[model samples]
Target: MADKEATVYVVDLGASMGDCHNGRDESDLDFGMRYVWDKISTTVAASRKTWTLGFVGLNTDETNNTQDEEGLEGYHNISTLQEIGPMTMTELRELHPKVKPCEAYSGDALSAIVVAITMIEEFTKKLKFKRRIILVTNGESPIDDEDDSITDVAEKLNEHNIELVIIGVDFDDPEYGFKEEDKSRAKRQNEETLRKLVEACENGVFGTMQQAVEELSIPRIKPVRPFKAYDGPLTLGDPNKYESAISINVERYFKTKRATPPSATTVVVNPDRGYTQSQAFDDGDVEMGGTEFSNVKHMRKYKVNDPSAPGGKLDVPYEELAKGYLYGRTVVPFSDSDMAITKYETTKSFTIIGFIPFDSYSPFLNMGETGLIAAKKFDEKSEIGLSALIHALHELESYAVARYVQKDGAQVQILLLKPNPGIEDEYECLYDVPLPFAEDVRSYQFPPLDKVLTVSGNVLKEHRLLPNQDLKEAMSDFVDAMDLSGFDVDEDGNPVDYAPIDEVYNPVIHRLNQAIRTRAVHPDGEIGPPPEILLRFSKPPEKLIKKARPDIEALIDAAELKKVPEKAKGRFKEAVKPLSGLDIDAILGQKKRTVISPENAIPEFKQALATAEDDETVEKAVKQMGEIIRKLITNSFADVFYPRAAENLRVLREELIGLDLPLLYNKFLRALKKSLLSGELNGDRREMWFKYIIGGQLGLVTKEESEMSDVTEEDAKAFVKK
Candidate 1:
């Protein structure tokens, strides 16, 4: 349980809020208000504490027209629609109509803050609670230079220890049609003023409306410290045969207190000033100058329903009633002034009693039924105690020690025990305390408390632990080949020289080696290291065909009609003739056949072309091309782009060019374009496909390249129209 909290939502109801945002039917104000309402509603519902909510409108026209020395006094347009108190869905629903923007001018935000502070202070005066004000606005209000009113309001809020959370909605969102050029100097000044106001609060969080709403919606539970194991030891007893003791651990659980509702009190108030008083007295009651004073009582009035009346209502006061205890009880009501404070207290205790022989208690520990004889005192009282103990043990759901206990001078003994944490009640226990030797004594070694554990030197010295060394070397070579820099830099940006291999690298390398050994196999008609590991450490194969003959045949058969031209049919057949006699099923084992089709490849290519500028899209394209290249290379094609599909490849290449990619990427695209245009390849496409082999290898296009591209806003609009 937590303490009570109060939150006041000060929403800006300016004319600008009426403008739609991001093409949405709802205005910015509508979205902002809805987000605020939902957030507050959710917080109230989910909070463990009692939460009170209030709503206030800024830039509203609920002010009086008053004149001062100046022609007309500035209006304090702040409107307190709902005072800070316990809020209900029905009450909130009724406020929708009242939250409309002002018809004349923007309301005074500074005035709204001052009013909200007053309301919250009045409401939470006697309550011990956390207070906060959530300001939802677009930061588009006119600044008031009247003695720094905004600063004064902020100072007052901070002095009261009230946290401020500003949800600033962007006015320039396209849906609002507020272009960058249309922003006025006043709007910028307002933004600066809002920022200053936010910074003035000690505990403040400022963010976009969406971000603020999301953060508020998320359930925020206060974190509790992790439970540490108890290091103290416990003693076990037999009470008759012998006492056996061992060091043990335990954790404590305490019950929580229930919340109580606030007490209500009745008070008399003055009608004129609306202030509560001890009694409702009039001027006539005080007759200081009179010779004598008369003591007269006053009767209160009430409203009663009457069907005969025009509005079915009637006014009356207390009158003669049936003389009974009920009427007298109603006249003089009673209430309790004293309140009870709840506290967490422990109600039960548990401990291990003793250990039993493994052979005798094994059945009971394993199957919940024991052959050991029950002690005489294992009666109703002990049964009840054992039931509670068993329930606690079951809830812990972990290992426990079983022991024999003698009671009431009985010959037979009972078994008592303790369990570990997180163990289930329904699970069978199959563990036992073993008597290791004929001497009936045993010893076990435990780690020294002060000792620091580290990896053994012998394990690091083993060569098999160096499998990841090759991977590291390959990575280094790849970086060198790519002319990469800044990977090993100091704080001052200078390169640091150190041995590539070090003690720190041993653990990572050993772990990687363990993973490889466990998951990979050796080559030679036997399972080999995974292709990824092999490819990282060694050069790629010229022909990426499976070891099995039937796989090669199957791949060739699938691609023959679609990929290979009639003139190249003989060459394709000759390339796969060597694999015609092997068993593909045995080599593949339980794995399903994976056929790479252009149907899948072309869609990925189109998607890549459309979003190549995106890192994620480029990465996906690289991976897809890797698979396509492997299949094409193994199927006797020197390149993926062949004469038979030149026209299709040419169209795709032009589309890639139209995207206006970076120079490095264009180079790779040019290679593909040239291959398509030439209708042949000198060697396997795999040899020159390194640039596109890794995803996210391309950088953003240069500014010059972006400007030189022919695509324009009008072009995109025309494309959309079509």
Candidate 2:
């Protein structure tokens, strides 16, 4: 379990706390205490081993009456109910009745801070615990004396490394019902003082009632250390040879290094010194000018600060360091002499001494006792190694030869075997025999080709019937019958055939001549000559055709027979239709007028209502008026329509009362209820609808308002029934 933290909640029980806010029935002090206690209980339940809570109420009845007490001389109106201790469900339940606003005066903010600090100091004496003081108030603290200020308390809290949180319940909240004139100047001053006090502490938070409560409900989860597992294979014996070896699992830790060289270059100059002359016994001539000066370049090694050694640094080599891998927590340094060869620092977490073969490897990969695979608790390395081996074998489509080590200290091993591509499955392994070449191998016998050959009599008959003369004659006749002369080619060289007119005329003319001959000998007696025959010759057979066909002549003169009669003459003339019996004068008058604004809509709505003959018509007009008003409100004319709606509702109510039509009144109320219940209005629109339409205009009681009013349950039942 982690170390426990001590939290002291400093609740304000001043006179102002007796006032209710936030649409609740209880006073602010009552609601705030309940909310705070609920959060504390939740936190304690979630982190039973990590949290201890305490309670302190300011401006209690006992503290308000007593001006001074030992060790608390200057701090008045402060009551310490519980010292910081492990919280329990019973203790939390007992706090509800104890925290109340029964005091006559406002709480002293500085005094409350002093009491909380003193309590926390004593509570954290034996055991060092994180301390926090939560002060919940309405920012209406009593004025401090000249000698002491809230800053003094904040300094003391900071010195002790305690956190201070101020939960401010704004008295000027609209729900509190405080007017502009009712806001005291001292309230602003008190708020500023509280803000300064919070700023004074290193870890202090000032928030509203809601923010404070919400923050406490969130669960604080401790972070876990991160780690990674090994993914490749590790074996004890040579991997390529089919030698018995033990499979093992291992984990790896990565180490990285950067090569940083010296920032500046240095050069060393060696000047040749002139030789000195010897004394009188000088055996050889002294050389004055010897060798020239040579410049040698040198580089300083870059050093990094060593955190383990105070005021110490270590030099780094110019070459890049090799990456190191560790199996466990142990770190092994890379060998500089053998830098070309890579090596892993591994710890034997598990050893596989046996092997079990199954038809499928999937069961071994599963996680339970029924699974075929098993491993040691510290076998992460071996697990990864075995998985890699199995994956490789599966990829290569091969199997392994399991061989257990027979030696006393030897580990087991499995050698993977792949089939030889050159060997056939049917052939046995042979050492001395060599196979013959493909061209030198023995061959099989073949049958004679002449003995297998034969011919059918039908083949000879089909040869004699080739290219029949009858088909050739028929195709020739078809080609001659088709008239290709009329066919022509277009600009694009594609054939365009105009249909032969002679083919169309011959068929129709033959049918017409047959019909004329047949009709000349009609059953009723010969009808002279057929008209088609006379008309085809271009002869004036109109007189003969007209005499022969009276029906045709009537059809030709039918247009003259169907002329409409002249408009009705004399006194029986029709009057103009009255335009579907509608009052054109009224419609025209309305069309001539323009609706310039929302205010103009109001008069028109009023006229509609006045002219309505029945309740149904009046209801329709009211609905239309409401639509107009709603549009005006959406268009930023709410200020105009709001008051207008109120006045109109008042007038309508009075008119309803004068008429004494209870049914109409009930219907109107039902419509208003439906409008409020429907989800048409959202957010601010809903609030506006409730404030103006339901409460102000219709005077309907909402569920919340009803609970606070004199209306009884029976009255509600009767209203709903109606």
Candidate 3:
């Protein structure tokens, strides 16, 4: 058995932002790359147990620094654009390691595959076992050329059985340049290419960085020890005194590997029924299972009767007796059995003798051989039958040992072979014992038999099988230690429940926030005003909302209604403010002759709609005109305050939907409640009332709020006052 278990090699190709965008880091772009890299690296490092890591950089393919002095050739960088290098575990540790700000070289796709595959092959050759390669990339093949394809490279990799994973990082492009038409198209194309690459390679892919990290993880492994072996009874006359040597010629009777059909010939034994089951007879009387399960001893019957010669003594040979029972048995000499064998004529046989096993001897044998000859009882111990009896005993012991070893799950062979040249020709055995205990003679003992045995090739008949359990455990331990869970990539990549959801959810919200903030800062740059407002104004909201109404009532109404007043108020005042103190009463109000002018019945309404030629009644003239006019004027004032009412509603709807809230009405109710609680408010503050209260957390505003508090209280107050 071996001391340590096998090894697995882990090559972590650390993350990189490809060299596509001129290596200039955009804030959103850099943030995304770092987020993905951190997730992937941390995940891979945590998962493996039996594996050791060998790190390599994929995009940064630097030149070879040393010459190959050991006649082992090295691979050249497949592309001139990437300056990549091979860093050992130590070399990587020495450097301040971080995912370098590298650009996606649209030509290094094949080079990346070549370097990765070659590195794994070379690294694992010394270890000499099954090797697995896990490559984590964003599925972006940097090679944009039409002439060369990475598909061919993937096929070559399939031959080596390296598992490739293309983790699609920044799957939802958070940057803002693409037009609305391109968003779905670009995303689809990127996803499709990613799918193709992963399919072309040997293994499947994990789409997001989160999944990639989870998939590349592993756990710890434990060690196991092997077992001990047992020995059986010895033949006293065996050549090695108390030893019994059985030579199993596995080639003649046993197969090297398990049989193709696995025990096609059946041999079964039921002790209660008193005989082995044979395949020739389908009945329970004959059983044939594995050689280990055979009860051949109980199945054999040697007839000693000489039918042709009536009342005459018959001669039987011990060699024929032994040969008839065991095909390839080897034996060695033992103590008193040698003398008994020389004195007794083993060739003698009797007339009219019947055959039965020694274990089932008739009552006559107990009364001595005289009872069987004088009382006309069964004949059993003919000279030839004794050899057959010995052969049966050998087979029984051999089968027991073979069955034991097989039950423990080890590989064992039952060899039936000729004995080695030695002192005398008799029966003995030299079966394989457990590794260390084979030499420990005292721990393993057997009962002595008076029969003689031989260690010579001629006297050696055949050796049978017995059980061995020690080897089985060793094989089982090997398989358990080599468990493939260590090979799973996702083991380490799983996210902890304790990890902050903001870190998980915010980059998405942050990108959306970025897109929203950009439009807020430069409305004309990308996100134009809402379709409703964009159609109304050629200029932006910043330029449009600057002017305000001079009417106190109108301004208060606008604030209460949460809306912007008409810009028409500013335009009209600009055009006509120079004349009549901007008095609209003289410009458009009706004339009256009553003590209280009719205009008093609806003061602001009169001015707002003075051009109305329709014969509408001024009923407040007959009632209390002053109070009625004021009410009418207040209602008109509200109309002037809320100008971009439609636009505000649209923008509010988008924000609420972006937040994934239940509905627009719910968001509006929330914003309304918030604004009512906080008296201090501005137009933008009102927008935020809708932005956060209605839109839920409004994503990643925590950083912005932190910066807000950093400004001095006085400055904040002053800024607020402004």
Candidate 4:
């Protein structure tokens, strides 16, 4: 029937097929074979109209010596399996089939099964809609009872990973005078052994020929093509009439698909922009950069603007956006200047800055868990590159330097603050000593107290006979009276006191020491306070040593001690030489606004005026004057009214000079300068131009001349000739 699936097999019983009768009567043998065959045929050919039949039988060893003289002299008859539609059957059959079984021989089940499996697997490998299998067998198996040789071959067939079916036709029956049960048992074992092979394949089976064929003929919702030719006699009962092909028009179906873009109506609210003008102005406009940009969105989305309102901006808590998209929290910020339009057009054509998913956390922040997991599972610690290590170190450094202060054993606060909304800021505590007791640099005066006492004694001895001195002397006396007590000698030579004594407490230093102590414990033996506490008290040099200890240890263990090399500072300096024609000071001072006339400016202007006599001369003088004025203006700008402002201007000048000003002027400011300098020269500036002409004649090369020298010889020749 069209619904039936096809199953076919080529059986190879090496040489023994002709002699044995499965140790039973021919009738019994026939009955057994027919019983299985009839059962399978009846089930498989239910509709009879569209049934397919494929068959092949070979006694390989028996036919090895026999040659086919004619078409059917020695070979067995076989039938070709045909495709059947859902509702049709075809006439086909296997007739006059011969079985020439041979005697005992060298058993090579491996080769036989390998060939059979290759054929079936190759055919069905690409047939996703259809499933198929092939059964190949020799009832007499050559498996050694002690060796599991058959199992070994069977397992290999299992790996071909395609549907398989096995048939074992043994002739070791008692009635056939073949008394050895080994063949029958071996056949049975071989047939059953195919389960592993069948299991490994998506659609595999193991049974007698009739039974297997019957199973193959059963209708399936999704029918699979047969693995081989069918074996049957030509009859009207053929079921090929019911078969029908099911084809799909892929081109037509896929043509209707549409390319999608993000919605134009999506208004992604920038959290930074959400702040009111008053808030932004007062808070200095929170400018975000890097991952902070993404973080702000996540925080804002989770916050309810009007949690109590019936229907406000955040009536629904923004946290709901985070519920399904926790894993998609890969957003990070970029500066507006850093953003490029091309970056937005990718495979997805994303809006790099827009649609900044309202709720998300930076995956970079989850590095602690990610790194630990990766390190454990993939040996990522060893595989991680220097860039990854650098990023991790930066994250660690930020976390390490952060300080949390707890006050009154209740309220907690983060001391570090962002420098600006855009820049990072950190907070640290400062020690402020009271003016009265500021001199007491230590607790309860032990080491520091001893030094103070020594100094005081020296002062007393130096002023021994000053008992009747002025208030300054009395104050000195009061200081000198401190000898582990608040006592001062009065002018009458008696002790006097101005203050009471009390026990001293030094909780600050004690707590600091306690914190250090707790950090010294090892993690393996006991979990201890962080190593940063000890690091804080250890001073710079020791702290550096402790910090590098782990990396040093790892390097030694990895046998990479040679990676660290001693520096040859002197050699490094020797390797570098000054470039010829380069004036170090001139290069360094390129950004400095040097005044053209260092002496009295009025005198310089008078000298310039004396040299200018004609229009061209005056024009030259004016040009020179203009240049001087520009330089002076620059100098004045660089040296603003305040000293600090001047310093800032100097820094600004250096940075400005770092830019390619010639390029900048050409691209952005040349036209503006031309516009400003246009018009007839008839004023005092014209006389200044004459002075510049005189200066040029006297061999003073101006900046314009320097620029002209940079032009190529060809360009220069072309310009001069023109």
What TM-score, computed on C-alpha atoms, does each candidate reach?
0.35, 0.33, 0.24, 0.21
**1-722 in candidate 3: lDDT tens per residue?**
33311211212232334323323355322433333333333323323333333333444444331221223333232222212232222222233233343443332444455555665565554443344444444434343333235576667667666666554444432332222222345345645665566677766443554433333221111232322222221112333443453322111111121112112344555555433223334443432221114434444434566767554535565445432233369454444555566552331111111223334422321211110011111323332343343355455432111221222334332211122122255433222211212333245566333222455623322322321233334445444443433322345775343222222222332233334434332335564222221122233234213322223334344334334434332101222343335665457774533334433323433333223222232222222332332233233333342223323333333332333322332323344444424633222234333443335432222212343223354543343333
Least well predicted 10-residue stretch by lDDT in candidate 2 = 427-436
The lDDT for every candidate, in the order shown, is 0.48, 0.52, 0.35, 0.33
Please count the clashing residue pairs in each candidate, in the order shown: 10, 6, 87, 72
lDDT of 1 at 606: 54
Instruction: Give RMSD (Å) of candidate 2 vs. truth.
Output: 46.7
Query: Best-fitting candidate, measured by lDDT?
Result: 2
Number of the top-ranking candidate, with TM-score as the measure: 1
| Shift in Å, residue 174, candidate 3 | 19
Q: Name the candidate, 1 or 2, with the larger TM-score value.
A: 1
lDDT, model 3: 0.35
Across residues 111-222, which tens digit of lDDT does each residue of candidate 4 receive?
A: 3444344444544454432333454454454533323544554565455543455544432233333333444555666544454444444445544433433333222222
lDDT of 1 by residue, 536-621 (tens): 32442333222234444444454342443342121012222223566554576833213325546665565454434454555455
- Residue-level lDDT tens digits of model 2 in 33-145: 64575557445444465688788888777663123556446566677777677765445445656777765465577777777787778768757788898988876657574
